[model samples]
Target chain A: MYANRQWVLAQRPAGEPDLDCFELRETDTDAPTDGELLVETRYLSVDPYMRGRMSEQESYAEPWAVGEPLEGGIVGEVVETESDAYDIGDLVTGQGTWGEYSLLAAADVAPVDPSVAPPEAYLGILGMPGRTAYFGLLEVGDPAPGDTVVVSGAAGAVGSVVGQIAKLNGCHVVGFAGTDEKTRWLTEDLGFDAAINYKTTDDYQAALADAAPDGVDVYYDNVGGPITDAVFTQLNLDATVAVCGQIAHYNAESVPTGPRKLPQLIAPRATVQGLLVGDFATRFEVATEQLSEWVAAGKLTHRESIVEGLSNAPEAFLGLFAGDNIGKQVVQVAAE
Target chain B: MYANRQWVLAQRPAGEPDLDCFELRETDTDAPTDGELLVETRYLSVDPYMRGRMSEQESYAEPWAVGEPLEGGIVGEVVETESDAYDIGDLVTGQGTWGEYSLLAAADVAPVDPSVAPPEAYLGILGMPGRTAYFGLLEVGDPAPGDTVVVSGAAGAVGSVVGQIAKLNGCHVVGFAGTDEKTRWLTEDLGFDAAINYKTTDDYQAALADAAPDGVDVYYDNVGGPITDAVFTQLNLDATVAVCGQIAHYNAESVPTGPRKLPQLIAPRATVQGLLVGDFATRFEVATEQLSEWVAAGKLTHRESIVEGLSNAPEAFLGLFAGDNIGKQVVQVAAE
Candidate 1:
């Protein structure tokens, strides 16, 4: 077995993380034991939620201890297995360490079909991000047909899918993305009724008003900050805001404050709900089947900005805050 | 038969409303038209919602025109009836002008049985406040057994009932109120598990944390602002926040700003839903029956801060902002 190289949290970041926060280290590979599978990493995911783990503060997720290897969604191939469930050639995806190799329990990883889709897809469109967009939008946002569905971070992994799903459901979909290019992709490619370039616009509320003329019925929020504050202004009566991720405030030095929204909510009779993908684990198979069907029908298009190599994983993660990725941010460790 | 004395919005206030904002006028009483009922106002409700109507700025409720007679919840006895639904001496409640005599359509008013409860109880316990507490708590808050339920404006109309209902449903109830007497009333009279006098406490978050040691499971938010912000800090995973009113921000000159709470909601997967009592009008019969049963059985106790005379109605409505009235604020326009 080759020596496993991994990225470990060297220091807890004060605000936005730099390269110094992560230490690329060479560690001895642990052999597969009974009931475990030694998987060689192929593709690793870099999501916004991982940023919360980098901090020392207590969040919904247990804070990752400093000096420990960063663990995330990883798509890997079964190299050597000591369990009865898998063979040497099966590709699996699960929560794993950001390394070349990880010793995981047999049940921890689910065997994925590369024939139905690409192996890297399990890290993006067909995986955590896909499920997050699905449940958070359909279950929490609860958009009805002909309703206006607005999504912040509309080009990111989850938000992109949320827009597409809302469009498919016969809703008037409006998207707020960071770039003009992302906005075009939303309107031209993804069937969104309107797209707002939030970075270019001085007044997001005005831009959103132009897009969602009927007002926002469902808001699937991935980027929370001023953009969300603007979205709150245009909420229709009985609006549902599904808080998927707050990527904007994830790296703040302290909990930041802005315009109070509680008052705004009362008049509209709106609903805002926080969501995590892990909570929908039980219904994953159902969501995956629906997501897979949409993908197969050419209705759902996915984009992945795969940064080549494990060493660039931290850089790719840091790039998310800069809006560097078009869709999913994945680290390609090795080709299957 | 007599000159109808009514209150009109004389001027829109810049900050806190004053007695000058209201002007008492003697208006001619309208005789009952065919299919209409002439009702003499007996018990008038002065609620926080009325404060929103006085403002020129558009809100959920229609703003009161400068010269028009103010309209609100009025329980009156039918003096003369041209409609088959109502008879003379029958107590009916509906939206009516602040004048002693009002011409109402039969469909506009509902016959309220004072024999089951009291004439004033219909304007208090089994009224809008009762229905507001019922739907906002059960439908929006969704408190579970052993869950910690926290309510702001605990001594007021809706809040006092929220704590009691939550307590009755087998939840640990914590309340926050402006005065020690109100807080004591919450614990001693209404069966709240703990009550914090927010006026005396410097750190409301700490006080709330102490009261809700297991963390807040459901928050029935009546007075939104810093109190709601403190509740957000102690929210359990999947907690629910029912936003009934923002009495704190109703009088603000502009849309007010405070510590942003959208970021805090992400981790806990909490839900904050804005509520308007009228939305649940379809199910109000069920709610009113439950509330009435509780009131009749002596399980529910209602205290009315009745301001005698219709001339003082404007002052009573303004008093809501000053935290002057406790429980349901009502104006006794005439004796039943």
Candidate 2:
């Protein structure tokens, strides 16, 4: 018998999650039943949304209970198959069991095309976050040609792709990031029209005015704070705001406070819509096809920050809240 | 030749508008040329939207300059005809100059039928606010049957109509009001399933939860503040928030600080959309016909708060900020 190492929720967090929130555990794994395949853990995605699931409250997805394995979307290789659907050495992606060797139902895993993109690409650009940016920006936000598109958290996985897609669609793309380096990457490398380093800026509203002089036609919002309020002030008539994430205020112990400027709703006739990627499950193929094509054409690019081992997953995941990760944060477990 | 009596903008207000913002004046009129005609103002509207127009900032409509006569959608009678298109004593609705007598282009006015509804009905049930409530709720909100529909400022013009329409559409209508009298009016006269007097209720979120046990599926927002934030917490999956107005925060000098709960966007996959009634101008007939049918069938009802005399218009308009008017506020300038 071999010990199966996994990460478990140690405690629910307050303002920010700490090391105590997660604990590494070793457990004995039983043999897989019929139709179950054993996958060797490889790439585990550490995302901002996982912060929400740590709590016990009811949410879009089930909460992660204390002492239970913390799960996330992951990619791995099948070492032993008890089902006819998967074979040995076949690489697949599905919900992570966190253990070194996890038993999954044949139905949960999907085969990946290695020739299309790198294995890590499935965890970032070709995966849920990528598809999320693809669908949320295109399907919901709907940027028209010459439209001024603004994206918050612009250096992150989803915001980066969203801005790129808007640029590709002939929009003048502007982005907001937490750092100067990220801002430079957006404007100089990622083809954004302008980039605002929100950290250094004294007035977000003024910065937005400078970046989008005409007015923001589409705001792909990932960080919902004062930046979003500033964007709200500058929205053009009939502007669309895709509420993809709100990492800025997620860990607050109490409700955050701000200007009661909701009256601004009267001016531009804006639409602020909240989106979850699972809502567009049926449209995944369409987004993947378009995204893959763009990547192959060198029109789209992605960056990832891969942590060394499963033990470091907690730190990497917590890094998202601190703006430490340059791009998508993923944990490399074992060699495929 | 008679000099026209008029009220013009005397000065801009620093906070709440007072008598100092307006001045009574008499001016000579120029004779109508080619397409122009002379009209006598009968009823001028006092609405919350005019406050937005008074400011110098860019908004949905141009700002009212100091020393200029206040202009809004009003009902009038054609006293003198210069264009071939109009005749004397023609009852018309137009964006009139706020004076006893004014000049207008023939094309600006529309002929009204006083037989179907009262002359004042043209200013209330058949007018701009009416059309605003009609299309903003039905077209954009699209409340499904059995949906828990919550409307703010429930005893006001737009909110009152929005509640009635939601009830007619088979929704469980819940209303929010500023006073006990308004709450009683909403429940007793407006057919709302429940009413919450926000001023009296210490916990709006708890009150809303009690009112809507199933959760809110449609929120027709007329007042945005803590009330809007409270409603955000109770939204069901795929909920729709039709932002028709934000009266609560309109007079605020700065944005209020509150618990920032934008993360709720991802939980419910919700939508908050701003509405401009003019955007649906092409379908005015559709709204009129449908509203008329509902009114005729006794499925919908409306109430008006009449303020006597043109001079009372400023005070009546300011009543909106204090939540004094129970229903649609209109100034009676003259008798038919």
- The global C-alpha lDDT for each of the candidates, from Candidate 1 onward, is 0.89, 0.85
lDDT of 2 at A289: 86
For model 1, the stretches where C-alpha displacement exceeds 4 angstroms are: B112-116
TM-score of 1: 0.96
Candidate 1 DockQ vs. native: 0.76
Top candidate on lDDT is 1
Q: Work out the TM-score per prediction.
A: 0.96, 0.96
Clashing pairs for predicted structure model 1, backbone only: none
What proportion of the true contacts does each candidate reproduce? 0.86, 0.82
Q: Individual DockQ of the candidates?
A: 0.76, 0.73
